[model samples]
Target: MTLPDFRRRKAGNQRISFVTCYDCAFARLVAQTDLDCILVGDSVAMVVHGHPSTLAADLPMMLFHTESVARGAGGKFIVGDMPFLEHRKGQSEAVSAAQALLRAGAQAIKLEGAAGNLEIIQSLVEGGVPVMGHVGLTPQFIHAFGGFKVQGREDAAAERILADAKALEASGVFSIVLEGIPATLGKRITDALSIPTIGIGAGPDCDGQVLVLHDLLGFTEKPPKFARAFGEVASASVTALRAYDEAVKTNTFPTEKESYA
Candidate 1:
């Protein structure tokens, strides 16, 4: 879907379904499904590459995956995730990074934060780049928060997130992602924004929901609490491999029909 269609979903009252994938294979596979959006999320730092956190992901890595996913998307809208410093340092850097991501085939770029990132978001949008803003328990800010903790539990913090979302909207973000917040707060932000509010751990009140493809398929080693596995692909794969190994060891795998010669 295009950004306009994605934005329209909020007023249309149509719930969206977004899934995150980092490689060309999954992107192509998901594009064939009923998903409304595909995100080349920075969470790949952990899910794909085995990094401890998103902080380990960089521009080159994100670019490589962005291009790969784009190749497989078949013209579907793909949001390339901006790694920490790509937008944090300054507007010029953010623009440069965004340009790279666009060239790499991302229809839009998503950055974490609102208050500190308003300038970057504004500059990008003004320069003809569409952006998606992320707020509430930003992973890039994990150091500051000490971990991936839920946010907006208290009145003051909830107000801060609301303010952040407003600032981001004013900065020209077409949509926003609300992560790790309460359902009430998620609904509050969704109601306040004209654009769509996509939730991860923020709950069912959002305009849409997104989840990592790995977690959704039960391929992740330790899935997060918010993730629900629809299929146990990992365990099934293990079992199949074990059966193959046993077949080979027992010399029962190659029957007359299985033999080419």
Candidate 2:
């Protein structure tokens, strides 16, 4: 289904759930769930490659993950993220990166910015590519903001956050992801925007919520504070691996009865 249709459905008070994935295995698992969307977020820098921050993720890396997730998503909407320098170069570069994502099987592309990116969003929309807007605690700007801190906590910054939400909506984005903001401010933005607001620690008042898949599965050694661990897959995986190791060391695996004649 198109993103506009998803937005319309969400406008009726439907709560959309989004999860980030970086590979086919996770995508396959997500496709079986009731998730409304799967974001191929650049968080792969942290979750997959052990990078210090998302800024280290490049276009090729994003494209690689986007392709894998798209191939395994089945029917879930795949939202590919444009990495740090891709969009800042100019409108043409943004369009090219977005188009490449669509070609790689993404149903839409998400970028982080407001005023500086309206033209790129408009151009992508006009060209028939669905776009999701991301604001608040944009990791790509960690240097400018001086680390991964909560945004919209102060009065002036909150106002700018509201303005950025409105600007993204006006630019024709189907939805906006509000990350790391106060609950009251998130509610206000959700109420003000025509498009749906998907929050990740932004607050409960948002139209929907999203979390990294690894975080949700308890695979990350240090997940964000706002993330609630839904399952302990990491511990379970470790236990299973340890069992296999013991079996191999004890010659308990590949018993004679298990061998083919």
Candidate 3:
């Protein structure tokens, strides 16, 4: 689907589905699913590169994954995430960073946060970069938020988040991702925006929902509270590996193929 198609889905009350993918194999796999968007999320720092935080990964790593995902994304819409501090320097830096991602094959870039990020988003949008704004428990703000806690729990905070969403929309974001916020506020923000809201840990009321592929596929041992495992891929991988080890140990793997000689 195209970026603009998300707005049409919002208009129709149809929910969008987004998932984070980092590599070509998974991107190709997701292309076969009914999902509407594949985000090459910066969560790759934690999921693929064994980093404890998203900040550990840089723009080059994110761009590498974006290229990998785009190689196999087929016709699926791809949103590349700007890594921690990738665009934090200033609007000029943000525009350059975003352009780098777009040049690497991202259809759009998901910029995290308000305040400083809002101005960057406006600058990038004006520069012809399609942006997806992210707010509410943004990982880049984890240290600032004192951990991955839910945001907008209080009236003032909720108002602030809602205001951020409004300002982002006015700045020309095609869509916004509401992450780690209360369900009531999630719905409130979703209802407040004309553009589609794709939620992760936000709530069921968003125009779309997203999850990390590793978390959703049961590849990660301990996923976040909001993530649900739809498959036991890790266990399946272990089982397959054990079987392969046993076959090789018993010298049975090449027995059938030996007949070709």
Which candidate number has the best TM-score?
A: 2
Residue 86 miss distance in model 2 (angstroms): 0.3
Please give, for residues 11-74, the per-residue lDDT of candidate 2 as tens digits.
6888888899999988999888778889999999988998989988898999999999988998
- For residue 118, model 1's alpha carbon misses the true position, in angstroms, by 0.7
lDDT of each: 0.91, 0.89, 0.90
For model 3, how big is the CA root-mean-square deviation? Answer: 1.3
Which segments of candidate 3 are over 4 A away from where they belong? Answer: 256-260
Q: After superposition, how far is residue 99 of candidate 2 from its true place, in Å?
A: 1.0
Better of 2 and 3 by TM-score: 2
What residue pairs are clashing in model 2?
none
In order of appearance, the predictions have TM-scores of: 0.95, 0.97, 0.96
lDDT of 1: 0.91
Evaluate residue 87 in candidate 1 and report its C-alpha lDDT on the 0 to 100 scale.
Answer: 82
Candidate 2: segments with Cα more than 4 A from true spot: none
RMSD of each: 1.5, 1.2, 1.3
* Candidate 3 residue-wise lDDT, 96-158, digit = tens: 888889988898999888787777787888888999999899998778988888999999999
Q: Show the lowest summed lDDT stretch of 10 residues, model 1.
A: 85-94
